[model samples]
Target: MEYITLNNGIKMPIVGTGTNTYGKENKDYNGALTNEIPELVTALELGYRSIDAAISYRNEELVGGILAESSVPREELFITTKIPAREEYVSSKESTRAAIDNSLKNFQTDYLDLLLIHAPIEDKEQLKNTWKVFEEYYEAGKLKAIGVSNFRKNHLDELKEFAKVKPAVNQIQINLKEKNEDLLALLQDEGITPVAWGPMKTEAHQQELLDEIGKAYDKSGAQVLLKYQIQRGVVVIPKSHNRANQAANLDLFDFELTAADVEKIENL
Candidate 1:
């Protein structure tokens, strides 16, 4: 797998598996855990080194269980979780610290590879206070890297005003359909890594282009789309419950898109 060095010098996998559907889709949390535990384990066994999880996903404990049982060593894996921007958690520094402690306990890991504020809250003061707590954890070694998700350029600019450590990443919905080049350029200018959450989705008008490109490389449309994002220097966390699909998503290092091909896709 490819790796990107964060501004803070921490290395993260360029591709990873997102575990958002572990318990959100199903009504029965227990049953969802029963199904998701082995599915996550299967992904690990199939060579997924990074796992993107969140407190809002409500399956960190199940993920922790699989981590304990997997043959993969802890040091080789990259685990990331987020602190939800609810009133109870982000209202004060003490609550934010407790939230981090809770996530560490749920994941059963002493230190997280990365932590992000799930989204911007209504109260800017509360968000800044929460970020202060994240800086503390980063200094204390509880978190290796810190970032934000779903934040616009204005939000980031505001945060930068009072932030001691600028965000290392900004996770957002970046797909073939919504390129959001302006936001991406801003991130680049600010020295923040762009992490794409829904990296594979493509518009109907773009499918023919992806398919034609895939034919040249003997890859699927999904593979070609993923390669496009990686070539553009974006980290992707594609979610899939199927083991075959999970494996296919990771099989992107063999072929590359040419400059011409990238330009064609960009024009679409």
Candidate 2:
């Protein structure tokens, strides 16, 4: 798998699997919070080393169970979780500290590869206070890297004003249809890694172009779209419950997109 070095000098897999069930009616599947454990096992078995999880997903314990049972060593896997941007946690220092502890306990892991603020809260001071706690954990080695998610340029600028440690990554919704080029450029300027959460989501009109591109590479339309984002230096965590789909997502490094192909996708 390909990797990207964060500003903090830690390498992260450019492609990972996101554990989130947004539209499912049944939140619990096979006794887990969601269909996380089985699918996670499938992903890991398929050579997916990075797992993106969050407190809001409510499946950390199940994921931990799968990790414990898997043959893959702890050091081989990159685990990431997040803190909710609610008042109970973000507004208080002690609660924020507990949140990290809780996640470690839930995951049954000593240290997280990465941690992020799930989203930017309305209160800037509260968010800053929470980030300060993250800095403390990062210094203490509980968290290998710290970052934020769903943050706009202004939110990042606000944090930068008082931040002692700059954010290593900014997780956002970046897909074939929603490019968000300006924000991506801003992240590049700040030396922050831009992680795409929904990297495979494409509109109907754009699928034909992606399919045509994929035909040349003997890849699927989704693979073509993922390659496009990866070429632009974006980290992607595409979620799928199917093992075949998971394997297909990781099978992207074999082919290279030409400058002309990249430009065509960028213009779409």
Candidate 3:
């Protein structure tokens, strides 16, 4: 797998697995939790090291248990989990610290690879307090890096007023349908890596075009879409339950898209 160096000099896998719906009944995001996550096991077996999880998903312990029990050592894994912006999780500094501590206990790890505020908090004081707690953990070495997700320019500007550590990444939707061109440029200019969440969401026509492009490289449209994001320095977390598709997602290192190919897709 390829890696992107964050602003803090940590290498994050260019490709990772999104676990928003994993271990849930019928693979539904709101489905009841299941005891086991065979898909996560399959992903790890397929060489996926980056596991993107969030507290809002309500399955951290399950996901964490699988990872703790996996054959892959903790050092080789890049586990990322987010703390929600809700009152229960970020109402105060003490609440925020407790939430993070519980997350660490659930993961059975001394330190997390990356921690992020799940979304932008509207209250400036709450936001500052939550970020301060994150900074505290980061300084103590419990969090390798700290960042935010789903933050826009205004939110980032608010954070800049007192932030000492620049966000390492801003995880956002960056599929073909939602190009997020302006925000992408802003993130690039600010030296923050952009991690695409829905990297495989594309229109049928777009997929057809990507498939046509992939034919030259013996890859699928999904692969082509993921390749397009990573080629431009954007990290992608594209998840699939099918074993074949899971294996295919990691088969991206073998080919490179031409300038013409990139232009065609970019214009699409």
**Number of backbone clashes in candidate 3:** 0
Best of the candidates, lDDT? 3
lDDT of 3: 0.95
lDDT by residue (1-268, candidate 2, tens digit) is 9999999999999999987752233533333344445777789889999999888877777777787778999988899888999877887889999999999998788899999999987797788789999999999998999999999998998998899999999999998767888999999999999999988888888998899999999999899999988888999999987888999999999999999988888888
In candidate 3, position 199 carries an lDDT of 89
Q: Point out where model 3 deviates above 4 Å.
A: none
Best by TM-score: 3
lDDT of 1 by residue, 91-129 (tens): 899999998999898877899999999998668899889
Give the TM-scores of the predictions, in the order they appear.
0.95, 0.95, 0.99
Stretches of candidate 2 exceeding 4 Å from the true structure:
22-36
Q: In model 1, which residue pairs have backbone atoms overlapping below 3 Å? A: none
Task: Return whichever of 1 and 3 wins on TM-score.
Answer: 3
lDDT of 3 by residue, 19-76 (tens): 9999999999999998989999999999999999999999999999999999999999
Shift in Å, residue 254, candidate 3: 0.4
